[model samples]
Target: MATAASRSGRRRGGGDDEDDRTAAMRRLRVLSLHLQDPSPSSEAGLAPAACAAAGRRRATGGADAAAALAAYLRGRHRDTQARVFEFFLSRPDLQTPVEMSTAAHRELCFRQLCALVREAGVRPLSLMANDPAEYFAVMEAAGGADISLGVKLGVQYSLWGGSIINLGTKKHRDRFFDRIDNLDYPGCFAMTELHHGSNVQALQTTATFDPVTDEFIINTPNDGAIKWWIGNAALHGKFATVFARLILPLQGKGGDPADMGIHAFIVPIRDLDTNAVLPGIEINDCGHKIGLNGVDNGALRFRSVRIPRDNLLNRFGDVSRDGKYTSSLPTINKRFAATLGELVGGRVGIAYSSVGILKVSVTIAVRYALLRQQFGPPKKPEISVLDYQSHQHKLMPMLASSYAFHFATRYLVDKYSEMKKTNDEDIMADVHVLSSGLKAYITSYTAKSISVCRESCGGHGYAAVNRFGALRNDHDIFQTFEGDNTVLLQQVAGDLLKQYQEKFKGGTLSATWNYLRDSMGTYLSQPNPVTSRWEGEDHLRDPNFQLDAFRYRTSRLLHSVAARLQKHSKTLGGFGAWNRCLNHLLTLAESHIESVILAKFIEAVKRCPDEKTRELLKLVCDLYALDRIWKDIGTYRNVDYVAPNKAKAIHKLADYLSYQVRLVAQELVDAFDLPDLIIRAPIGMQSEAYAQYTQHVGF
Candidate 1:
């Protein structure tokens, strides 16, 4: 079983091919077991028992709790996602990793997934279309099933296809859109370089226009200029949306060769008929990633490659036959901004998918907790792990956070969809800031949640059968991809400061800006007075109190950081001043984002139609907001946001709310409504887990 990856890696002397092959085989062996369904009859035998607690445990019937939650999460698109999820899950071969461990296996699986998507009659390009409900439905379904598969879908749809649709003109669309939708022209978005990831302006790859031949000469001058981490590049990718600096002779201002900033072009990487790497193009596999090894991630380099001048994706800017560059944008920076703005959809997709992963992890951990029993009183018997105060403490808060993130991600997607139709720059800037902050916050939150979920499962979580390891490994990359979380938060911080400055000048303010404006005086004046008598009405369960606490903290932190930057920039220079205050800035960004999530969560809670659902969800919301403040109660205490005794009291209130949430914990996770096919982990099968284990040992 020498994988295509192994053969190609060896052929190119990539030196890591053997290691990749070994890892794939190892992963396949472990992953294959989960693909098997432990007797459907046995599975049917277990569900009633698992749901028995739902009937008697709390006000919301236990059996219906998960289904209700699922209904809420799936929203108007649940049926669509369910159909798509079942299509992939029904095929055991498609579910297994036998065709996903090596380069060959991954290529085969990638093609299969693409074929499945096409067979479903859902076009990848439709995602970039004005109405993106279907596109997001597919993403939610695929991501829930497998993260690697979801990423492969995103690469083709959101990145490569999106680049063409959003950045290219009519000529480019007519030439490629049909083939792209049909998967006849699998493509990669080539933007990140070896020496310059995240910092696209510093990329070194060059596309020099040759006026004599009316073509562009694309080149990778140094090793650092090579495009890296490009999905589908080693195999399967026939073309790429290449981002490179545009150099034209004597074209700017006077008689000078104009150095237009990074622009995208469509370049052929492989011969369409033979699937062979084209001349002057070289690719090497990025072998054995911790997760997502199923994608054919590869590095690419170009050497004096020539393409027709028409290959430029020039919706924003274009060059004439004489090499004169003309752009509708006023400056190079604006041009580049317009180009990169197309990628905000990709960021939105990643954040949405990250929430899906969080749901899966939490579902598995919660289900396993119900079935798993540890020591109890000697006279009684073993108690389910869900009963332990410590266990509830670990899993419940994360469960609440997942719900908050789910709603927040939904808010992000709606914003993105609306912005696509309008394309208003001011609205677009707000979308960019919100998406960056959210992508960073949600992915970081997911990573922590998955890790906690894994640990909550104890020894079983570490095993492959539980699937937490893969979820954690696959999800960790989200923190860096789309944009690095840290840098993105800084971008949010910068935007906040800019908005704050605008507020001071009496400029018109947006809703969010107005909220910040109204709060400025309170944040700067003094922390609110803490009452001598601690009232539960002013604590965790009170939405107004929660909102006030969050709003005050965010505004205070944001203003403090702004004041520091104002004073320090005088002597230290702009970059130095910001660098010195990076921590405060990041804290400011995080607090702002947390406030936004709380606001969204509270609003959603108010709109819940079911009284029981509303009541329970409000408790979850309380846990989310209060736990957030509990973690940093020290800061609130220091600033008199809460008196020291009240700060301690709020911490106690947060812990008590966690217990309240624990009473309906099973129903809480069930609200996510993940199917067993997606849950995959054996421990999540309730009584079926014990049956499968015993049968395996021939008991």
Candidate 2:
């Protein structure tokens, strides 16, 4: 029988003597190198010097600075994230995709995720707490490793669990929160209908209050009313928090049931004990999707399901024993906002997770670039692809964005933490608007970055073992689900317009809304080529200048779109006019979001504890800001925001910044602190990747 050492040697392509000789040669070579050195320096004495030299070469302040930046970027949840990564690595069952023919693998993955949640003592209602940062950190880490698992957890804790915490009263929380947290009662969030996804107000599903039985009868009146894209509904969910139009009949003044608008209710979906589908709840699997197959998304329908009146998540709207509808808020729209506001947590969580995934993509691509060398001058050693201008162009801006979004997410999480502590109307509106816009912007950017990372790694990135396929496929849904990116941007545009109108009417503005005031003064004045012309690189680097340019661009877009909208509305009414200006509306929303990210990024960089970290990150900030400006150069150029020469300079500066960023590309990606276990991609292992490849498969 072959010995263990011999088997290992055989796998690595060797024999016993060859391995021994090779080991002896390695030791001899090290000894020779030390003997050959003329310096009297000890190994420990020389280590710091070597690190410092490398840091200088990388242009990242030094090793200490790089280390500080890494720590800051890894965040406060590193210990928890490390443990999660280790736990995932230990379980082979969790590492690979299961075949679609049998959902048993998906079920296994779900069970593992549930086990992790149970151990964490975290539930969806946890988001209601002022500090759910730890839980969100874990979710973001998990998402970076496995998108399906992260999304499943989000469905359980943020979507389904959060709805109960936000929309339901104490009675509902008492009945369900603990069980849901413990996985004793699995649930799904049912909101999107077959015909209406983004437009919840137009949903056809209804819950009619029956005075006779004192129950709310839930019904999917038509096929279009089927609740679609519901996670865990096919097999796992025991109940769902169903959003439907509330119908309460008046005693005398009634032609049809009084429309009480959209409301949420907890309806049983399956038998908790038998794990069987319940009566009146029809469910069918949505089958294969572009990604996240581990999550059993399904379409659901209710056929006159009678749930008790108390089933309503009535924190905002409630029905008395006599079937009279009453609400704490005066209007239905206010109630809808209050109830659906629970989704803000999910949106924020997605933004964090999106940054996390982008970090992984950047990490893999950067590491692979460093290890995989290509053509060089004749009779010279091959150079790293990362040294190529085009390669740097492909990745460094994305690298900068990964950092920008990282800081932006931290700021958002902190700001949201404060907002949850108060009931201030203005702050809440700001939070809602920011969360929607950031979610749309960050997810879309991450998706594009993932694509770039995949292409950067060439053919290896396309392989499942390399992890980019999974990254691209799983995250594709994020741009559509939580809130469709386009639809969410519209919300941002509407909120901005409201603030713009308020400021024009001389209403007071909060700090975040101060830009709207600035907008009225700046964009409303007129176009001036000389005034808007771009200055030099020094001027571009000025934070105040960047802020002004961003604010001006956003304001100009808003002003232009609103003006066009007014013209269309005069002839076509509000909805039709809005439709006509949809493209401009999207641009307006995106520009506002970009400006907010830049502001937060600058603020975070300023607060860096280490001078070196701050200096290095400032360059990253420049790259992020300038790259965004470059993308919108046409807009700026068209509006005379910059001279033609300045436009040319902007393009040149972007290339130069990309080259500067390339010097520290590895260090920047390393700041994310993703472990090899989570990264999984062999190419991501760098030099060892090739060795491991050669060892396993003969070259």
Candidate 3:
């Protein structure tokens, strides 16, 4: 019940060295009790009164609670995927050193990847086809072990193998599935060109159909059309799932060929027997990246590369031997959407993996805070860094955010899995918008969170052995790849406008968008005086109030952005108007995604079956909601939705909630269940942290 200042003041009073040491040991013991085995038999190691207190703590929220929460966070596949994570921990050979050259790191990552498949028995094709949840679970575990290994696996399986499964027909699958599964046909995804990254429809690489030879000639027409940053292409991959403009030649005239939009093709870039770059194909290593050097990213250029006609991944669109184009989709735009839609699993994976990175980073920061001691009252033992409000302020909210994102990304994964199963247009549309928005939202948040965590750990975080630098470098590309965060946000905003129009037209809204309709009356009404002035802790923490505030901000932004676009379009026209309002559109998109995350987090808390665990989660949720609302208070206050006094109260409440969360920070991170071997940072060890860190630094 004592405040941090009071605790420090009490320690400042005179005490012998032996007394100070004893007090510190006692505090460490109490703080670490939850890290011990929570079994009743383990209590025999403690005194009777201590054992009784430990029993009470376990009943409230302890190791058992952490285990239950971990299971819940892992979802239905927790048990099935346990071995996947354990597999990495058991193999010391799979672990990369703290330092290595790009070439050496790439070779090590490749060897580690092979071990993951051959020894660990990771069947990505089978899991993705039959068990998507398990496939993602395995991916999270792999990414937690090594970002480079995860990216390599994603390129080979999720991008290359997935293209065959999702975009190609049975014959294409029959030809390549076995080879890809056994690692015989190493491959890369060739989508981004030098001139175009996210603008897939504008990519200039051409796949010209040749009816005479019954083949497709793939060519990079100019320097800008060369495929760039392709993983596994420089030395490892023998094939690539190439994205290009499918062209049909004119029958008699030779003016121009008909461009049938962007499509994917199975193009062989290297020889199978000798691992040599094939004729007319040029591959160059994208050397010395800032991070993820373990991934062999390369640039690919093709000059009149020819492949059989059947190599086209033609589930959505196809061409005949007679040079005629056919597609189930009615128009090029719809076909393009469908083609890109099939690959959305990549975004889902990135969003999920970003959370994994945050979990590890936050875990290290929080654990180090608990162990590292610094300034305190003179003549007293220095207090733990976590005891300071500033340290808690920096870390607890992020810890809370890690939990919030855990549930939100879990929802995304489940939704993606459902979309794959039903193939419902509505679900597909929801998944597309959801994936893009969450992918941008979560990755950007994590990118910032990693820096914050690294700074929170002070000098130790700067050391390479602690992993913050590598984590930052590897994760930095996540926001740009899959889709650029900026462009992806616009996609979400564009969809929001479409739904807003659909609401006006009296069309039924999808489940995710139905909130748009429900919030119409609330958002348009004048601010409620009573609700605006209510600033008590209960009011601030209420799920209803938090959700309403989030919903109101998004709805208001949506309406205002729509009106601005309409007004601007009258003068500037559509493209110009959209460009003028890009900033507003991004805010609207981010607001909408934050609302979705909070809604999902609240729902997850309500669904918890364990009362003690649920109670702990509710506190974390409160911190997440209030901290976000408090940060954006200016937005709420400008509209008179929150009074000055209420704004102050929200800020104080957020601070208090952070202090509360810090009390159980260890238990919260323990639920992530990362092992020491996987964590790899000596300073983040559960016990003997100082010794491990000293040994790591060669003291």
Return the top candidate by TM-score. 3
Q: Write candidate 1's Cα lDDT for 1-699 as tens digits.
A: 999987776767645767778889887754432122111122223221122232224434776766665666667777878887778776766674412466655765585567566676767675557566567767878876667778888888788989889999988888888888888889999999999988998899999999999999999999999999999797879999999999998776787777899999999999999999999999998888888777888999999999999999999999888877889998889999888887898898888888889888988888788778765543445556766657777888898999999888888788888888898777788789889999999999999989899999888888776788888888899999899999999988998888888888987655444568668788777655644235453554678888878888888888888889989999998999999999999999998899888888998899888776777788899999989988888778778778767776676677666766766877787677778788878777534875664554477
Cα RMSD to native, each candidate? 15.2, 13.2, 8.3
lDDT of 2: 0.79
| Models ranked on TM-score | 3, 1, 2
Comparison by lDDT, 1 against 2, better one: 1
For model 2, residues 1-699, the per-residue Cα lDDT tens digits are 999997777767757668788899998766543332212223223221111211113543545656677887776767877877777777666664423432864686576677566654444345445456777887886776567778888888888888877788899889888887777877899999999998888888999999999999999999999999999887788889999999987632656668889999999988778988889888999997778888889999899999999999999888999888778799988888887675688888998898888888888898888777766534545557776667877888989998888888887887777777776776777778888999999999999889999999998787776788878988888899878999999999998888777777878866565766656678867666664565577887778877777888998988889899989999999999999999999999999888888998999888888887887888999988888888888988877778888877777777767766777776777666677766767788734786664554457
**How do all models score by TM-score?**
0.89, 0.88, 0.91
After the best TM-score superposition of candidate 2, give how far the Cα of residue 406 lies from its true spot, in angstroms.
1.1
Evaluate candidate 2 by giving its C-alpha RMSD to the native, one decimal. 13.2
Name the 10 consecutive residues with the lowest summed lDDT in model 3: 48-57
Residue pairs in candidate 1 whose N, alpha carbon or C atoms collide under 3 angstroms: 4-104, 54-62, 66-670, 69-671, 70-671, 250-256, 250-257
Flag the better candidate by TM-score, 2 or 3: 3
TM-score of 1: 0.89
Candidate 2 has what TM-score?
A: 0.88
